[model samples]
Structures are given as structure tokens and as C-alpha cells.
Target: MNPNMTPNLMAVLPTLIIMVTGMVVLIGDSCLKGWKSTKSLSAIVTLIGIAAAGFFALSRITEDSIIVFGGAVVIDSFSNGTALILLATAAFATLLAMTYLENKNLNLGEYYALVLFSTSGSMLMASANDLIVLFIAIEILSVALYVLAGFARTDEKSEESALKYFLLGAFAAGFLLYGIALIYGGTAGAAGNGGTTNLTLISEFLRHTNGVANPMLMAGIALLLVGLGFKAGLVPFHMWTPDVYEGAPTSVTAYMAAGAKIGAFAAIVRVFNAFIPISPYWLIALQVLAVLTMFGGNLLAIVQENVKRMLAYSSIAHAGYLLVGVCAMAGNPRAHDTALGAILFYLFGYMLVTMGSFGILIWLSKRGHDCTTMNDLKGLAKTDPTAAYTMLIFMLSLAGIPLTVGFFGKLQIFNASLMAGQVGIAISMAVASIISVYYYLKVVWTMCFQEPDGNTVEGRATSSFGVNVTVGLSAIGCVLFGILPQTLQFLINASNSIMRP
Candidate 1:
């Protein structure tokens, strides 16, 4: 290796690979004429690219952190681990989409390409060391997702979802960019560095200056939080979540719920942890947001009959749980390991369960029918025992039942919060979780105990080997992680070294 070469290349190698792969896929699709050839080839390429990226990310397991691109990006344990998770998520989602699109005759070559491109953006967001780069990455990811959400443009609901998401996402991006400009202004005037938007420089400036509490800096931080909060789907800014989830294609919804949340949490953790000296002022804001998000999300989920809508609310509630981890880090920067570890564990568990649950939706959406309502699952056990069983495991895991990955995830989060003296937030989380069980179990009951409606009873049932494998793997992961919780703890500890605090 060249002694002058920076290790940051190794950190962002996955994102760079995926970005190149996306362009190749796009070109191939444009040249390839037939649906079967384009779909199969594109899917293969996408999976291979994601796997390659993940492998590259996993290979960099050293203890040191490296900043790349003139300090515009950072490679550390935290980002590398998150990049692996994001790539895996994109790969599995592509697999699910391949089968789903084939069944629905919706396999466009651009779909896989867009997913890879968006995932690359999310990876960049996770690793970004500069505010401008972070904002750009967020827009790249958001734009792709907006298009994907409205992929079924023929459907009015899909079109509506896309429009709403686009408008609100654009609005959020504006706030974020403006916030970056303001923060740049504050730091620039004080440091004579022409408004340095670099996070490390900003941190140094805050440390050396008496203007840490400058009104402009506070305003910028608030705007930045609002922008990120919208993406994370926290309360008071989560209005778009339910409608979008209910309207988007099921596979896309799963990708957004799992992969997007991981990216957002990673950004949140980085922004707060890296700027900890001035974070105390915002800790109170996060505390209040966490409590409200937990209670409000669970309460909304209780009344939703549409399974997708309910899951949307549940996603918000999960954001609240993650926020507790964020709050813990703010209050006790020394406990970075515990806080970040819990967040990652929770994200890992959440991805498995959510993907498994949405896999059932994709599998059931055969012959142009979208089976999204709770009633549609009635008599699922009788018609398709394997899918029902898989969904059951997912439901139980999401409900945080014992011997499931979700249980261990919650345990770690609660432990972290307790250690950080956020007992009230933890207690609220527990209660909300109890309330959530009712709706999650209601699906299980509908699947196992209720009689099938005439339409579903007469409808054909089909299962693809690909869907079966995905669901089976996810269910096994939930059970295995639950049984071997220490494995996750170790991974979390290893990843913690990259966190800024």
C-alpha cells in the first residue's frame, strides 16, 4: 500500500462501487430490449453489486478512523457497519422486488438501478463528514425513494403518495440546506474560514469560541434537527408516513421502513455525537420528542385497520425508541458504546422482522391484487401454512415477544436508557409496546383463527421459492438472534469504536 494513501477509500469503497454499478445497470437496461432479459440481468447485477459493496465494507475492520475527500467523509466502525446493513437490505429488497415485479408485470429495468443508486446515497449520508455532502446525499436518496414510491403511477393512490412525499421531502431539504447555510455563516464569521461547513471544523470552532450559544448557531441547529426529524418520522413531522406507506408498493414500503430508518438514525447519531459539547441545549428537545413520538405512534397504530398504515405508525414508534438511545448519548457522552450499540441492535432486529412481514405482502400480491388489509390475511394459515408461520414469527418478533430478536433489541435499549437515567422515557416505551401487541396479535388471530372471506377462499394461492427463502431466512434470523443475544452485543461493541463521542 502507498504510505500516502488514505484509508477513507476503504471506508467508502462500497458506496463508490454501488454508484458505478447503478450507472452500468442503467446503460444495460437502455440497450436491452426484452423484459425477461432486462429484468433477470438487472436483478443479478444489482444483487452482485450490493454483495460486493457489503464485502468491501466488511473487509475494513481495523480500529482506526479515516477521513477522506479532504475531510468531506469519514470512515469508521459506525459507518462501515451501517453501510453493510444498508447494502444487505438493498440486496434482499431487490430479490423480493424481482419476484414481486414478475408476478405483477411491473418489472422495469430502472427499478433495480434506482434502488442501488438510492442505497449508495444512504450509505454516503451515513458516512458524510461535511454538512453540504450530507444534505446532497439526503436529497439523492429522497428523490429516488419518491420515484420508487410512486412507481405504480397507473394507480391513483401511488401517484398521490409520490406527490405528497416529493412535496414534503423537498420542503424538508430546503430547511436542511438553509440550516447548513446559517451554521456556515456563524462559523465562518468567527473563524475567518469563509463559513466552513465541515463538521470537524465546526466542532473545533465551537470548542475554541465564546459564541457556542450564538443565536444563529442555535437557530441553524434547530432547523437541521427539524429537517432530519421529518425524515426519521418523528412526531409533529410524521404526517406523511401513514398515507405514503398505505399507498406505496409493499416491497418499496419495506425498503423505506427499514433501510431509510437505519440511514436516518445513523445521521442523527453522528450529528449529535460529533457535536456533543453544544448538544446539552438540544437534549431537552429530544427528550420531549421521544416521549411524544412513543405515545402518539402507538396510540395511532391501535386504531388503523389497514396493516400497512398500522406498520407506518409502528415505524414512528420505533423511531421514538431509537431516540431514547440518541438521548442517552447526549446526556452521557462517555456511554457512547452502550447508546450506539443499542441503536444498531435495534435496527438490525427491526430490519429482519419488517422485511419478513413485508415479504408476505409481496408474495400475496399476485395476479395484480394487492392484499394489504388485515382482513385479507384471514384464513392465511389454512391456505398457506408456510407464509402464515413466517408472518407469525415476524409479528411476534415485532411485538418484542421473548425468544425473538426484537425482545433482545428492546432489552438493550431499555438497559441503555436506564443507565443514562431516562427511566421515564423507558417506562413510556414499555407501555406503548404493550399497547402495540394488541394490533400485531390481531393479525396473528386473523391469520390463524378467523374464517376466510369468499373472495380469498376462492382466490389462487402461489408461492415462489425466492419469497420462501427470504421469509425463512428472516424468521430464522429473528429466532437465532433472540437465542444468541450476546452475538449482537459483541457486534455492537465492535461497531461502537467509530462513534464520535
Candidate 2:
């Protein structure tokens, strides 16, 4: 073995482990013909793989930044922390997928493998230090998700969602690649540094230039923002979110809402932190996007009768809240530690609520039936108290009620924005949060106060033990994290110490 290759392999051990495990799962599925249950085994293997990756990532927590593959990737605390969260989300999503797929007769080995690959791609994207590598990582993730979204090939809505997502995703990738090319050209002409595509080098160049903004660089940054904004489900680029979430399998939707957001935000942090000196230009653009996304998402959510689609709009609104933290980080790079901390905490809380909400939906949906509308949930509390209570916890948390994780998450971002002196934005965020309460509570009212539609069977939630566990864990996590945020605060601080610039 080459001596130099060993160290590089060690640095990327987590990604390698996931990739290899995915291949093994594929092979195992082919070999285990007429097995009792391939879905259960697949979920177990995926969970074990993610746990191993998390362990490996934690082992490197104390190690300084280790650049791999000639600076294409960099392993640091920020990347490691984000990787852990991605793995955790993927693991939970796999469990939920297994239960839901089995119920819907859609269980397949390929689903588990695809989830692992997508998660690995997200981790790679988070750690990537080179523009080309980031683009490649994103494609790996997007391709897997597109296929997953259309896994129910027989469903017309699923097929339509997949097509729309693929076309728009491809278009966004083109813009991102063009932006990279522009940045390369500008750097090559000005500094003669062989058209450096490394983010660190570009940041250093900008810092030394004393605020001399390049038109090419500015254009590149704008395109890059557009691409990332689409992935993060921000407004003007979030048209795909509601349709896709409504059409996709509930389990896949949960994964997208949690894991995808985590990966996108991770990349946003890496890019913004490395290119801090030129953030003023992007800050203004993000400010406008944030406002539009916040108000638009909430307004659209209020009008949505479909629960899944409403949650999609709610996800967009949460992304807007996250952007507030991103804006603060951009405005004062020196204070990015707090902003980063807040973003991580918010994501953790958001993941629990999102997963719980979707899991309950899966529980309520029968094999041939889709429970997408709020009307489907009318009188759910009277029919199935357990699932209804779980959903209530999710809704309350999502609405930022006290004693729920979502409340603390919003508080963190609001405090960060206030610290950054964004008073108007902060106040608008508060008003948006209030607007959000109306729709979220509408679901609660339907469950508790409204009569049953009389067309559907009752007690749909009583049969699934696996879903019960998932929902219970998520609801409990929401309350625990909300009441005692210091645990997450400590983790955030630890993550910040390793990622500080």
C-alpha cells in the first residue's frame, strides 16, 4: 500500500464505511432470496453503518483540520458534527422507512442502499473544501433523492414530482458549475494562482484585497446562492417543495425534510465562513430572501389543506429562520461561533418535530390510502389517542410553544439576530411565528374538536408498534430538549471550538 494513501483513507473513513456498507446491503439483498423480511435486515444494516460512521467521526473530534485528496475535502469539528447529525437523521429515517414501506408493500433493498448513499453524499458535501467536489457531492445526493421520490412508480403524482425535481435540480447544478467557472476565471486573471478553486484561498484573496469587489466574483456568488437557496427550500426557488412532499412516500418526505436541510445548511456554513470578507454583498441578498421566504411560507401554509404540503411550507419558514442566523454570521464573521451554534441547535430540534409529524402521518395512512389532507385527521384524538397526542406534540413544537424544542430553536435564532442588530428582521420573524400558530393549531382543533368524516375507518394508529416507538422517542426528545437546552448548548459550544475561524 502506498504510504501517503493510508492517511488519506483514514481521514475519509466514515464516508468509506458508509459506501462499502451500502454495497454490502445490495449484495445481501440479492443473496437472501425468500428471506423472512429483507426490509428489517436492510434497516438494521443501515443503522449499524450510520452508527459506525458516527463513532469514527467522534474519534476525530480532537484532531486538527486534516485536508484530504489535495484539499478537496477537509475534516474538522463543524463537518464532523454535521456528519453525526446527518447519520442520526438517516438512521431514524431508515427505521421509519422500514415500518412504512412494509405497511405499504413497498419494502425493497434498494431503498435502504439509496438512503445510505444519499447520506454519504451529504456528509461529503458538508466536508468538501473544493467547488468541484461540492458540486459532485450534491449530484450524488440529488440523484438518489429523485429516484427515492419516484420509488412508487405506479403513482402518477410521484412520477410528476420526480420529473419536476430532476429538471430543476439539473438546472440548478448548471448554474452552480458556471459560478465556479466564473470564480476560477476571476482568480486566475487577478492573482495568477492557477485559478484556485479552493474556498480558503479565495477567502484569503478577498481579505487581502481590502474590499475591492470583483464583478465576476459577485456574479459567481449570486449564482451559487441561487443554487443553495433552491436546495434549502427558500422562496422563489421552493416551488418544488410542497408538490414533492405531497407526492413522495411519507418516510422519504421525512428524510428530505430533516437530512437534506442539515446537509444544505452545512454547505452554506462552509462557504460563508471561508468567504467571510465578501459577505456584505450576499448578506443583502439573503436578507431579502429571508423576508420573502418567511412571510410567503407562512401565508402559503395557512391556505394549504394538505398536512404534508403545509409541513413543506412550514419547512420553508424554518429555513427562513435559519437564514437569520446565516445573516448574522455573515455580518460579523468573528461572531460566527454563536450563529453556528444556534443553527445546529435549531436543526436538531427541527429534525425531531419533522420526523414525528411524518411518522404519525404514516401511521394513519392505510396501504392504498394517502392521508395527505388535514381533513383525514378530523377526530383523530377520539379514535387514536396515542397517535393524536404524538402529533399534538409535533404540532406544538413546530409552532414554537414553550416546553418544546422548536421554541428554543427560534429563541436561539432570534437572540442571534438581535445581537447582530437586525431588529426589524427579528420583529418580523416574531410576527411570522405568530402567524404560524394559526395553521398549526388548526390541525390540533381538527383532531380534538371536529367530528370524524365517517368515510374512513378508525383506530388506524393502533397497529404499528414501530411507528409508535419512533413517535414516542421524537415527542419525548422535543420536551427534553426544550426544557433543558443546556445539553445541546454544550454540544454546540464543543462544535464551535473546533470550527472557529
Candidate 3:
């Protein structure tokens, strides 16, 4: 191994802190016996750890890139920014879990521990410099998620969600591993060395040999895309998303929706940025995938009666929108800063909006009422104006309506796409957003215009305090960032870091 390439502790401290926090929660939970609600202590621990990690990450928000752990991980503005986003997702989800699980009878120490583990895995994925490290991170995130999906053991649907996710996730891992092997074989041979999984080394080898036209390398790239495509909820690999999101506990669903997408896209950016030499070979395929995902996800969401499933499809559509920025970044060698900035901003917006949407579900839920379907939300405006208005903002944001975070995010992404010469995809994305408005507005019309269905809960006087905090923060984030995104200038630095030499 190259000595200069040795791993540095400072570089990975954030992820390490998160991992250590999970271990402590696990050990603490096992040793201390207390009221079921007291298990929320685990959540408290998890939040502190996440905030610490975020602090460490923010402290290192430099524009220059710094590789560590033999280049298996990197510390840069991009990594740090992404780490903050992951931490925020974990924090908000943990907060929601505090009250959410207590009500559902699923509150346990292990639940918070799993969330920390999953979030740390996502943090790893964001900074990974090697394909092997990325794969390991993916597994770490996926395994924790499988368990969290079914944490509500009494629910058959939750169990089913866990099973399906595991099976499909295993296959996707296979695809990624195989792709890594192929890239290694194809490039390492050219370098007269044994196969390696370090992305930088592979990129260097390919660049020296002008390997863009090499078939084996192309095959590997395609396979890697396939694997990542699944995690990002892109088309053809998205079958697992709806069932998983709808079946999993609402808090877990919120976690998966944002955390998973951010991590997957973070990896996608790293891989494609490394493979910029082979842009022609992969750009068209990716563009096609983006188009299919956007149209397909929106069309499917329009027909769904279940709000959770609609959000599932909506998540897929948002994934497609993000893909537009990814594809654009991959194609525009000189425009990565703009492309990445847009992608980062969009993810931030989507995270808050999606989290708030599901956070509302967690807030309104009763033991017998999941608050899942459209009918369940009828006349929600009449009984709970705050919840109704909150949902309205979330809905408008998702629909990309003017002045909402979602709208600005979409605007930035489309601007980036056009700058990258992806005019066709940009136009397609607009149409899909317009089409999405129908369903999004359908949600608004249902909650505002429709009468109360008997299905709506008499409502809870005292839901978990954590959920209210999550809802309030999410609501504030959506509008605050939408109106005054100047607060997010760190993201610009973060995006710029990824484009550095």
C-alpha cells in the first residue's frame, strides 16, 4: 500500500463518532432496563452523536479535497456538506422516532442504534473513495434499514417490506460487486498490476490508456449504474420502493426516503466524476433512465389512492429529477460546480419536504389508524388546521409550485441541466413536474375541499413532543430555505469541492 495513502483518523472522525455512538446505544440499551418510553434515551444519545458528527463535518468544510484511509474515504466540502445532510436526516428521523415508536409500541434501544448505524453508513457512502468501501457502506445502510423496516413486528406488512427489501437489496449488491470486479480486471491489467478497487487509480489508468472505448470497462460502468439506480429509486429497479415505503413504519419511511437517496446520489456523483473520461459511453444511457423514471414515477403516482404509496411514487419522481442533475454533471466536465450545487440544494429541499410529509403521518397516527390513505385525510383541515397547512406546504413544495423549496430546487436543477446541454431532458422534467401538480393538488383538494371521513382520527391531544419538533423544523426549513436560501452558501462551497483536482 502507498504510505502517503494511509488512512487518517481526522478525515473519518465524523463517521467514527457515529459508529461509536451506535455501539454505545446498543450496549447501553441491553444493560439498562427501564420504562418503555425511557428507551428514548437511546434516541437522545443518537441525536447528540449526530450533532457532534455534524460539528466535526462543518469544521472541515474546506474547498480543497483531502483523501484519507488510503483513499478509501475523503474529506472535502462535498463530503462534509453531505455528512451534514445525512446527520440532519438522522437527527430529524431520530426525533420523530422518539414519539413515533413510543406510540406504536416499537420503542426500543435497538431502534435508535439501528438509525445511527444506518446514518453512519450513509455518511461513509458520501465520502467513499474506493468502490469496495462504497459497497461496504451500502450494505451497512441496507442491513440496518431492513431491520428498521420490520421493527414493528406485530405488523405483517412491515415484515413483508423488510423481506422484499433484503432480497432485492442483496441482488443489487451483487450487481455492484460484480461491476467493481470487472472495472478492476479491465483496468488493473492495463496497469500491469493485480485488480484494484480504488476509484482514483482506476480513473488514472483509464485516462492514461484512453480506455473510454474499452468494452469491459463500459460493462462495469453499466453494472455500477444498475446497482446505484436501485438505491436511488430510478426506473426498472424501483419495484421495491413503494411496498417498502408504504409497509415500513412512517418514521423509517421518512428516513429511507431522504437518507437513502442522498447516499446513493452521493455515490453516483463520485463514480461518474471519476469516470468523466468515459462520458460518451454512459451519458445517453443515463439520460434515458432519467427520462423513463421521471415520466413513469409521475404517471404512477397520479393513479394512487393511498397517500403513502403516492409519496412513494413521488419519491421516485424526485429521484428522477435529481438524476437530471446527475446526468448533466456527468456530461458537462467543466460545469460540475453548477451541476453539483443544484443537486445538493435540491436534495436539501427534498429532504425537509419529504421528512415533513411523513412526519405528519407519524404525528397523526393512532394505534388503529395509520393515517395512510387519502380518505383518512379527509377534513383533516377542519379538525387540525396546523397539520393541514403543514401538509399543504409540503404538497406544494413537492409539486414544485412557485416560492416553495421544491420549486427552487427544481428550478436550479433544470437550469443546471440546460447549462449542460440536456435541453430535451430539462423539457421532459418540466412536463413531468406539471403532471405531478395534478396529484399533488389532488392531495390539497382532498384535505381542503373534501368533507371529513369517519376514518379520520378524533386526533391525539398529546402525541410525542419529538414529532412536533420535527414537523416544525421541517416546515421552517422548507419555506425558510425557499425564501432565504442564502443561509445555505456552504453548499456552494461543498459542490465546488467535488470539482477540484
lDDT of 3 at 280: 77
**Residue range 351-393, candidate 3, lDDT tens digits:** 9998899988877787756878888788888978888899999
- Flag regions of model 3 displaced more than 4 Å: 1-7, 33-39, 190-192, 460-462
What TM-score fits each model? 0.95, 0.96, 0.96
Each prediction's whole-model lDDT (CA): 0.83, 0.84, 0.87
Q: Which stretches of candidate 2 lie over 4 Å from their true place?
A: 31-39, 189-192, 455-457, 461-465, 497-501
lDDT for position 38 in model 3: 63
lDDT: worst 10-residue window of model 3? 31-40
Model 3 clash pairs are: 7-69
* Superposition-based RMSD of candidate 3 using all C-alpha atoms, in angstroms: 2.2
For lDDT, the strongest prediction is 3
lDDT of 1 at 223: 90
Report the alpha-carbon TM-score of model 2 versus the true structure: 0.96
- lDDT of predicted model 2: 0.84
**For residues 1-501, what per-residue lDDT tens digits would candidate 1 score against the true structure?**
675554555557889899999988898888756735543888888888888888778777444678887889988777888887788788778877877776666787788988998898889888888999999889888999999999887889989999999999999998998888888887765447577788888877776764256777778888998999989999988999999998888888989998888888888887776567777678889989998998889899989888899999999999998998888886564555687888888988998888888888877776677878877788888887777878899888888999999998888888888888878887988898898898889889988998878645332233566566667788899999999988765458646665453
